[model samples]
Target: MPVLLTKIEGKGNGIKTVLPNMSDVARSLSRPPTYPTKFFGCELGAQTSFDEKNDRYIVNGAHDAPKLRELLDVFIDKFVLCKACDNPETDLTITKTEEILRDCKACGERTGVDMRHKLTTFIIKNPPKNPKKSKVKKATADGATTPNGDADEDAGGDSDDELTLRIKAEAAELTADAAIAKEDWSADTSPEAVKARMKAVEASMASVSLAPAGGDDDSDEDGDSPFAHLGHWIEENREESAVEIYKKAEEFGIAKKHNTMTIIAQTLFTENVLTEIPKYAPLFAKMVTSEKHQKSLLGGLERLVGVLHPDLTPAIPKILMAFYQTDILEEEVITQWGTHVSKKYVDREISKKVRKASEPFLKWLEEADDSEEED
Candidate 1:
């Protein structure tokens, strides 16, 4: 939540504190920009105007960024965050009783807001719209209605007919003799047969275990690993744009592969990765589409920070936050990644260092999850 403050110059009444990025800040907080702007007005006993057309939020008089930020924090504590889970993912609903309730999506808790505040009246008057209800209504109108208005009855009858046919088919497959044969079935309990089955199981398990290990060893040494080749190409073409890099990766036929993001992460940035992440975020967004890709990208980052640039190892939380903000990483993936230290990505010692540096962010995530579970 970076504040972009602009102090307006002119006469006494014309002078004001302009928050150019208030809308972005409000979006990140999942609150209407007017809510926080009005809150500042109420707290400072000053006038506030929001020119939504131009996305300009102005607070009367000359207020410093620090003071406004502090006030915004107070507003968040009272309005934005859920009381039960302290999660920002809440919807402010004005009940029939004129009380403002925060419905938390994370914990499913409906907690009341203090009605005594000046902002409460404003919130009650201008309640947050529930897009879900409108979407449900649209779906019902589009799919649940018919010209004769008999869609429900027809759907129910079709389902019942399908069920009856399935039941009849299942019944036709089951003869009395077949049922008797199934019930009379038995396995061989002879010692020789049991030993043979055990030996077969052991042989299968041994083969399965050895297969992957041998294949991995061969692929790694044979220079057939897609990740190794992709990383090398990316390192050589470091000056290319993200789109160009992606096109080249597509030519290599590994753009959509799960491990491609790992290669990109490992090769794309240097020690200044914290600043360079935004530049290459699009490449990551394109490659890392699923949980597996996210995990692989994290693995690549583990090597990048933990193994490659140990000085940037302490910046793990910032790196994760950058990825999270850029929409490259998700909360579940990050939480799972932080819970365990694996040698698959980096050596055990380096993995521990990365996880240790990530403790603060991981602790915050754990606390939020714990609070959600408790509620």
Candidate 2:
């Protein structure tokens, strides 16, 4: 017969032949079951079982391990949030899987809250209990069978074999829970590391802002930022403007990659938009390379494309072709050029340019279109 490890006359005794109510056991193990039919609305999944060769319950692929893992993750997240806020103190209760409740523990009022700031005080309401199913484990004839032909009625994990299975299951659950705790700790730690990185970046930006804005020490500041000084010089002097402005922007943090792009983009077009490209090059290039900058890039590109004349775009193919012909550009420049052309061009109009400036870009577009069609 099996036994319960309980206090006997104010002393911790060995296992005694008395089983607690199944309802009391269920209340102690609080996480809800994912599969209603298999678990029967009981929190039995948390119990350990040492059934398989690996000393763990074989939650085989047939049993939907992935879905079960997802449920466990979500349940743990809710449990952590609830524990953080001492949720048992409040009378709030969450009902459905989709419904999230955010009420103040102190005032019992709905308050505007940022979970990031309230990391130590966030509660998720308990999901509604499913009362349609039974929580008790049904006793079977095999479970009641005893040695020497007498009936043995024990509760929880009854036989030695069943107890081993239960222990393995519990051990597996503890291992899984530990893994989840480690992941959560890593994620929480990352925010601190990210804050430090952001601070270092800001420091570098401040240093760049304070640096002298030209290569030549002889160059005069003209009482303003390098850009303003360049504009003034350009208004006074014509042929020297482009080189001087390009030089000035370099010292002010316009990247070398962008400078190359600006030169290529300007070579095939004749519009005043070239001036605007230099002005926004830093923001545009930063957006092009950064995942975080994607939203800003999308909005800026849409606005820029919307205001631009259709005539100005016709020169993109020409510029790309020139890029391909240069041995130095090879594939890197050609790829970026191709991306630029595709971002701004379509099939019918892509062939308008026949010059040395358009050939390479056109060939790339045709091949890309063919590959896409095949796929």
Candidate 3:
């Protein structure tokens, strides 16, 4: 029940209905503004433009607050509210079966959305950017830790173990107050338990938490030269993994402080990217799980391949293999991405060439599966 503010823009015949605070409302509703704006246009038979970067949504023709509010109510009932819990805290997920599902973040229940609706089509095209999949730990035969590690396959690619994925999805049981009190919060109510609990409480109540013994902070906010300074620091320090570089990026506070992931992407990868992909991919997967990081990672790669070595387009196949091996980028995402010439990082022509170069590898992926089935 958030307030929707409307402003009439342009002169006379060219006027449009502008929702100035649509982004804020969308943020509160845990949805992208474009989804609802498209819904309004579809419902009203009017044209709508979503200027996401500028945080402005304009719908063609004039509309009063009452009319707009009524439209919003229908959208909320259809899209925002979770069908199971009736809670607005839900994520819109497109299942592997291509069904639209409203996953309630609060109640942890998934309700199917009717696919016949006009709004469902738009939601399908624009999947949610928020990637919040839980991280799982795997123990090796010799007691090793791998963060979604790959299993070597016959055709020079890797896949995740089905058992690991299943075991990782242990059912969640919400504990009640009665259950907690009965268990006494620990196995035994002996002196050792009390002492341990007191120690934990004291640690939690400590005045200031200290950093680990050898941890470092790279925060340098001296005007506009933080990244330049970061570049120099990266050159000086030998970061073995992308995960280490990502941690350094966070420590620099650029992701939070500078509001840019470009610097992190640039410094994270080594000069010989193809050779380093295997070494860095495990960590890279973890970093690019977020939308901002994914964009930056893509942009950084675009600059590297598009600007640095445009002629080395053949390497795109093998380079993408590492990402695919680690399960970082999905096939549908890359295929949809290939159809576009994004100018977010490099020149349109260069990005086009990179996408074109990536086609064979993508096709090979599909054909490989089909070939396996035939065999």
For each candidate, give its TM-score against the true structure: 0.42, 0.21, 0.42
Question: Predictions ranked by lDDT, top down?
Answer: 1, 3, 2
Q: Residues 191-273, candidate 2: write the lDDT tens digits.
A: 46435533432232221122322342222443233423332333233233233434544555442322222222322112444
Give the winner by lDDT: 1 or 2: 1
Runs with alpha carbons beyond 4 Å of true place in candidate 3: 1-225, 240-243, 256-261, 362-375
lDDT of 1 at 284: 66
lDDT of 1 by residue, 1-375 (tens): 656465664568788888888888886666788899999999999998889878988988988888888998899899978999897766687877888888664455689988899988777777774433332233234345321233322332333224324433333332222221111113343567445533432232222122222133213444355545555565554555665667677776767676666667766767778667755554564456556778878887887787566898877877886676444576667878888888776668988889888887666555545555565
lDDT for every model?
A: 0.65, 0.30, 0.56
RMSD of model 2 against the true structure: 29.0
2 against 3, candidate with superior lDDT: 3
> What overall lDDT, based on C-alpha atoms, would model 1 receive against the true structure?
0.65
Give the per-residue lDDT digits (tens) of candidate 3, residues 1-375: 369989888878798999988987787676889988888899899999987767889899898878988999888878878898787867687888789888764455788877888878788888875421211111123333222233323322222444223322221111111111111121233566445533432232121111111122333343224444444454444423343455566665653332233444444344456555554443444344333444455555655566544555667766665565455555545555666788756557878889887776667555544554565
Local error of candidate 1 at 191, Å? 68
